[model samples]
Target: MKAFLLLLGCLLATPVLAGPRVELVTSHGTLQLELNEQAAPLTVANFLRYVDDGSYNNSLFHRLIPGFVVQGGGYDSGYSALPSYAPIENESDNGLSNRTGTIAMARTQDPHSATRQFYINLADNLSLDGGRSPGYTVFGRVTAGQDVLTRMARVPTGMNMQLRARDVPDEPITLLEARRLSEQAGGTMTSEPVSKP
Candidate 1:
């Protein structure tokens, strides 16, 4: 009976074991990012940890460079930066590319230094993909809502780039909310609202 129960548990837990998909519902619309657990398990898992922990609630898109990228997941609603944790090891060699619409972790000039923040590629940032240095790890792709990203790319930007000394939006975009997407039998994961943060 114990063995049978163990097997049943495995069967019941298989779906969650497969990891999760996520959605970023910005002011423009919703974006579906399919996390690649097999390729970047640690990174994907860490991202999900942030989601479940409510770390990204009401975080403003502190940095926005039109035609470059839309960045957030760190600062709060009032533009005050949050206390960041230690840097994450670089996983740029995880076989994902910095192609347009792909989602990746944002880090400092140092490679292997990713943390809570992430960015969506507005253009093909081949330079950051290790040809010259350690590339940015591409942990997921935008499965939906590219139109919303395009709209974000068009928002006027200025010189308030986060952490960097260049290319930031004068008026930052706020990430209204973020949450884990529900599982589908055979369809892409869809998100349910956790809270408005």
Candidate 2:
């Protein structure tokens, strides 16, 4: 009985392995994102670099389209596009959809032009799913802080000369800090082996 209890305690202490976890500390609230490496490996790895390097700190959510998505991870409070590394290949065919709360890479019309910018879907954006169109890669999802995203969607927006773009938030919502959530939870944020489609 003593041996069994010891083994059971050891098993309970073991941590379950999981995908990478990221925490976004925005002015509105903090959001937890779990990147899906199995579905979007390259994109996940690229985004994690920005998180690890503290590039996302002080960044602002530059674009917010009603009933569409809240886009960020690139611009500062001044609405200037931040420098980024080389773009990664589109992995939208990885069976993930641009569903509500799902996070997707933001790119130009060029399918392979996603670098640092990303967006969170506010609705089921089937238009972003792959089929006839070159779909945006869905890499992660908002696991917490949906209220923060919802508040973001309702903020007043307009064209900004700084961004030279429409749908810009009149009052900037800043991402105060970003870090790997695992660091606080005693887990390491490591990229996993991606199974190809």
Candidate 3:
């Protein structure tokens, strides 16, 4: 009886591990993302910081390349650049790949320059995997609403005078809100609004 009781206590003490999930409410539609904290802990934490602080709310999908990627989480509805936290270390060596439906960080020429911007792969981009140099860090995958992303990809894009960039959606695709999912309830956790600087 004591052995069985001890086993029960051990089982109860062991914590359940669940990958963090975020629900992105966008003008196109809602997307569910499951992050691999085990593979890319730094990247996942960076993304969750924005989600938890509501910094992603009302952001626009500023870039879209039909056959390549759908990028965002940087500019606001007014086309103004949002403030970002300090850059994070590159975790591209994480086993994750830039496969279709996988979300990865967007960075400058410098490998560790990734901050607030991210992109979702529209196709399998094996060339992005780490080899000669560090690659893009893919921290999560879209668990739902891939069709919405397809729709966003199909939207007409052109050079925006404000952004001075091409591939800007003719009609803005806004991320209405982004919130973390509760591990036990399968419901969203409310985030405090982050004031733009």
Q: Identify the candidate with maximal TM-score.
A: 3
Candidate 1: minimum summed lDDT over ten consecutive residues — where?
160-169
- In model 3, the worst 10-residue window by lDDT is 188-197
Total backbone clashes of model 3? 0
- Give every collision pair in model 3: none
Instruction: Give candidate 3's whole-model lDDT.
Output: 0.91
Model 1 stretches with alpha carbons more than 4 Å out:
1-19, 161-166, 185-197
Instruction: Put down candidate 1 lDDT per residue, 1-197, tens digits, no spaces.
Output: 99999999999978655446787767678888888888888788777777877777678776777666778898887667776667777888878888888888998888878888999888888776765567888899888898888777777766543455455555566776788888767854666767423
Candidate 2: list runs displaced more than 4 Å: 1-17, 183-197
- Give a tens-digit lDDT track for model 2, residues 1-197: 99999999999999865678888889889888989998899999999888877788899888889899998989877777788989999999999999999999999999999999999999999988889767999998988899998888889999998668899889898988877764444454433322222
Taken over the whole model, the C-alpha lDDT of each candidate is 0.77, 0.87, 0.91
* Candidate 3 per-residue C-alpha lDDT over 136-173 given as tens digits, one digit per residue, 9 for 90 to 100: 99999999899998899999999999999999999999
Cα error of candidate 3 at position 94, Å: 0.5
Please give the TM-score that candidate 1 achieves against the real structure. 0.79
- Summed backbone clashes in each candidate are 5, 0, 0
Cα displacement (angstroms), candidate 3, residue 145, comes to 0.6
Predict model 2's lDDT versus the native: 0.87
